[model samples]
Target: MIRALLDPSEGEPVQIERAGGRSPVILVCEHASRTIPASLSNLGVKPDTLTSHAAWDIGALATAQKISQLLDAPLVHQRFSRLVYDCNRPPEAPDAIPEMSEIHAIPGNRNLSGEARQQRVAEIYEPFRQALAALVAARTGPSRQPVIVTIHSYTRVYFGAARHRAIGLLHDRDRRLADTMLQQAEEHGITNAMRNYPYGPDDGVTHTLRLHAVQNGLLNVMIEYCSDLIDTEKGQDEWAALTTRLLEAALERFDIHAAGSQQA
Candidate 1:
């Protein structure tokens, strides 16, 4: 029933959303939403679980929206349960089709045979990859060098564990973006911002950054918002503004301007 109800053609991919013309930049949110269709009642999830971190990034969707709006850049977001399949994950990872993400058991995804697994890869996963390829392909111009920016969020605590830290900016050796953003966040008085923790590009092994950024050797940066921070409307606005300022400032120093611009 769940499979039958899926509307892949409407651009309701295991991922979704794309906009703006060519730019030197691309924004991707891998854990944007947790919306399964009307069928299977969340593929057999309990009520509480459907709205939890296992499903979505908690605040990433709204944050991504704000960033896309502010930057006037295209954003591609994953639209289904990360449990059904994590678009950020490489095809071969064991947890690529996670039966359980953290504490939530995705009964619908458990123990599938090779054919079933491959079908999911074909039907849902492949379309997204192809669309991404198309996005990259479409981004050709005389002055543009495509830079991929991936948006994501993390739980404030690990397994309900506690941390005094408020936020983190996760990157790996991408000094151009990371240094600038880190400095901007600090100068902006975002006192609790950590340089990198919980996870970094090294930690998110099969992440979208690896798929597109590292593979293509483009400028890539991934930001992780702590869920508790952007879990509210006011919170979203504040962080979005913060992100925009820091990123724009950073890009300028790096001489990375959006393509299709007057400058470009």
Candidate 2:
């Protein structure tokens, strides 16, 4: 029998915020939590390392939460550390259970048995993806499709180099939504917003977009905020308010509307 990676008392692996929201936009935060199950023993890494960006996107969840509230959009976020199983990555990707993230090596992920990998996927990844799919399907239809937006954050300094971009708008083959958001950011005096800065679709960070948005022929985009900029509640609020405005403007500018009847 395969041992369960997540215990019943550990709480649900997926955190759905505003599940019944009526907005046409669906928000996803794959690296929202840094909680490692007690069974993994912090994945053999130092306790402090679990608090770092390698474990989770520091301010991405808070910012995402603010955006969800501002837009009244349903948000689906993972409750486990990305180090356990990166929901945004395809299972075949080595980094899904990374042995090394930046300069920090993860001892637990090293030389894992096939069953170990499968357990994580079964417990953490599939449920989140399914929930997101169901959420999107319920809101989308033949006449219209809901927009998919993922929120993420990048470190200001990576591999000893400083990154100056404050915001990054990433996309794959389809740039429809990203292009419009970038234009709006620039017009709103937010010049730090760049297309595919820090990381892009080519970096294998677009799995969620590829699986849900691109494959399903829906408009989608990923926004990356500099972790330092939105690290605090005040900062999250400011960025969220700004992002909400830009998002609303983009939707109106593109004449996009909720596909089905709006739900509370």
Candidate 3:
């Protein structure tokens, strides 16, 4: 028998907070945890690499949770490391189980068999995908329309090159929410915001947005916070407040009700 990716004691792969939240906004943090399944033995990575951006999006979960609290929105996050499955990516994507993330090479992923890859997909990605899908579906009727907002954080420097942007509002073909957020950032005194600076759809970074939001014709946007900016509780709270304001502004711009119903 193939060694299982997740043990019986490992708990569920997807974590949903405020599942019954009244807000129509559904927040997602795909790279929330740096936890590798004990079966994977840390994927043979170094101690520091195990906690680095390659393993998870630093500060993203805390920021997302804060946004969820501020908006009374529901949050769905993955419990396993992105190096294990990359919940944002589809099963066929090349980097879904990356062999290398930036300068750190993933030793266990180097020679993964078909079964190993499939195991990660079945054990890690599927649960996260299904939970998020179910949440969206539940909010997708005439009475309520859900918004998809995925949160993430990026490193100050990657491969020795520094990233200057403090925040990023990314979107795919549908730029409705992202555009409005960017426009409102300056008004909120957040002048360092940029459009698709750190990563874009071309980089396959918008998988969650494309799959859950664009395909469903729902309003959506991906928010990227610089790691250094949201690395503390104060920073998380500050960014969360900013995100809540921007989301409210965008919803109002679209005439979406706070109760999640369309004005019509």
How much RMSD separates candidate 3 from the native structure? 2.4
Which candidate gets the maximum TM-score versus the true structure?
3
Best of the two (1, 2) by lDDT:
2
lDDT of 3 at 264: 21
Candidate 3's TM-score: 0.96
Candidate with the larger TM-score of 2 and 3: 3
At residue 112, candidate 1 shows an lDDT of 79
For model 2, residues 114-202, the per-residue Cα lDDT tens digits are 99999888889999989999988888877657889999999999999999999999999989888888888977657789999889877
Report the Cα lDDT for residue 3, model 3: 81
Better of 2 and 3 by lDDT: 3
Tell me the lDDT of model 3 at 10: 95
lDDT of each: 0.71, 0.88, 0.90
In the range 48-162, model 3's lDDT, one tens digit per residue, is 8987899999999999998888777889999989998899899999999999999888999998888888998999999999999999998889867899999999999998999
Worst 10 residues of 3 by lDDT: 255-264
